[model samples]
Target: MTAAKPIRCLAFDTSMTCPGVAIIEVRKGKPTIKALSHVKPNTSRSHAHRAEVIEGWAMLFLDKHVGTAGFDYVVREDFAGKTSRSNYPVLSAWNACERATSRFGLTFAKYKKPGKDTEYLGISATRVKSLVAGSGNAVKDEVEAGVRRITGYAGTFANDDESDAAAIGLAWLIDAGVIEKPKGAG
Candidate 1:
């Protein structure tokens, strides 16, 4: 039988100021990082402008790298509207990502193909932390360390945003069976 095509997962740790992105590719059940970067839109700009910048950036990135083939999964850290005040700005950034993913033809739900169990949308930060660090309440530093251990990545991440994006992507990979879950994970 012929070999299967490699699967790509693009994950994001979305924020209005600086959003992180990571692209992970799995081939034959082994996973590797394809790219990691963050967009730092001007904080002085209005929320609409920042959101627009983020949307444009993501569209360009997808076009240049992922192309028409697109990613098998696109995930972002869920926007938990925990505060009483309206989280309009944060929601805008998240919506920008949603638009970008939709533009590439990825539906905001789990794929419905038979025998395929892939998720495609927001994943809770607590869930991502639990999957990556074995604790739902894992701190940012702990999550970063756990990502390093799980992915066997030794290089330093530019910031926590990048590491969080990696964590989010790896967690999805494990959940989707694209990569094996690490030993001793709860």
Candidate 2:
């Protein structure tokens, strides 16, 4: 539990099980968590009626966060690019992110090492695991343990996707230099 940063940011997660949005504003040494939302998604394996709902939800989220001042960047979970799998939920998440960025005119990006030219950086699952937990090959239980240790939430928060999304946001916050890096590691 270190000090937060004086930076404003919005993070989102879109999928069949969990859809979430969070807005964190930091300024003048004052950090404010303005908004955080998570709802059970109305989705299906085939992505039934998902695009329309995503558009609507993304519009609402944008209205809430990017009303007058647009967000600096939009961060979403990046699919591992496994062409063999037919994960409609994963595709839906990617598509929803794409739609959100286009709808709000927000730039999409990832934090890749030594690559600053493109907005989309190569963030992989191993990196996320390591960033959220201590090891790249950490299991879900380990991730939840790290998250609980970091956030100090209750027992019900275990295995929740929203909590994982928040951890991902925290990772980006630290990576972007928006927040102070974790102790003993960068």
Candidate 3:
């Protein structure tokens, strides 16, 4: 019997200063992290310039991966809320990511804030943490540790941003049934 083809996914945690990105492949319903990286914006520049630089970086990252064997899905963490005063930059970056992914005809799945509902498709942050760290309230380090434990990833993570991004991707894998739920997850 032949094995089922793997599903390749590109996931991101969008931010103004640094955005986390990961490419994963699911084979036989098991997800494996293939590549992980972050887009660091030049903070010395003005806000507008920073946004442009971040968008350009994001585009470059996507361009580099979109054609390499091609990705079957693109996922990202949704904005926390629209009312926050600091949401503008994040929204801008997210919009750019959406546009970039759409240009390739890929529908980006936006994982919403934990325990919230919106018109767009999403999975809550609480759900992501619970699935990834066995606790919805798991702190950054714990979540990062959980991701390494679950994926058996051996490389050192650059920062919490990348870890969170990886967690976001792992959440999508669990939600899509590409991977089994971690033990003790509620």
Candidate 4:
């Protein structure tokens, strides 16, 4: 029997105030985050308009990233709070990511006939945090440290929401055994 190919993934966070993206390329047994980007919106502008701005950014992100072997699953964060989530930044973030899900689905031709579809996973921030930091209540800094601990990334991670977003994808990759550990642990 032949071996299976490692799945590739592109992950991003939708936020007007803290827009970020992360992509993971898993080839063979080695998996690495190929790209991570996070940016702060202009202070002069409020996040209320992010729905539109993030839409544009989503289009740009897909235009640049989507391809033959597009993301197997586009993992993103979701909220199920009872309160309306149409707040400025929150609303904009949702709008931006929603576009990515639709586009990624089409890009992968998952919408074709039947039994063939690319799916997206909207992970809760708590779950993702727990997977990485071993605690759902892990703060952003703790999460960042966990990322570095796993990936050997050394930097401020100040704008690393994109990196963290991508990290979730990596965790899924590891959990699914699409990627393996480096060895010499315990």
Ordered by TM-score, highest first, the candidates read: 3, 1, 4, 2
Cα error, candidate 3, residue 163 (Å): 1.7
Q: Each model's TM-score?
A: 0.84, 0.71, 0.86, 0.71
Over 1-186, each residue of candidate 4 has an lDDT whose tens digit, in order, gives 977765776666666677777777766666666667665656576555645667677777777777666677665665455565445467557666676557657431111211435443355677667666667787877767666666666655556676677667665655556665323211
The regions of model 3 sitting more than 4 angstroms off are 82-84, 110-121
**lDDT for model 4:** 0.62
Best by lDDT: 1
What order do candidates take by lDDT, descending? 1, 3, 4, 2
RMSD of candidates 1 onward, in order: 3.8, 4.8, 2.7, 6.0
Among all windows of ten consecutive residues in candidate 2, which has the lowest summed lDDT?
Answer: 150-159
Full-model lDDT, candidate 1? 0.80
Model 1 segments more than 4 A misplaced: 84-86, 110-121
Error of 3 at 103 (Å): 3.0
lDDT of 3 by residue, 112-162 (tens): 444557545445668778989999899998898888887888887888778
Top TM-score hit: 3
Over 64-133, each residue of candidate 2 has an lDDT whose tens digit, in order, gives 7677766665676555555635566667666766776687778666667544555443355565567767
Backbone clashes (count) for model 2? 0
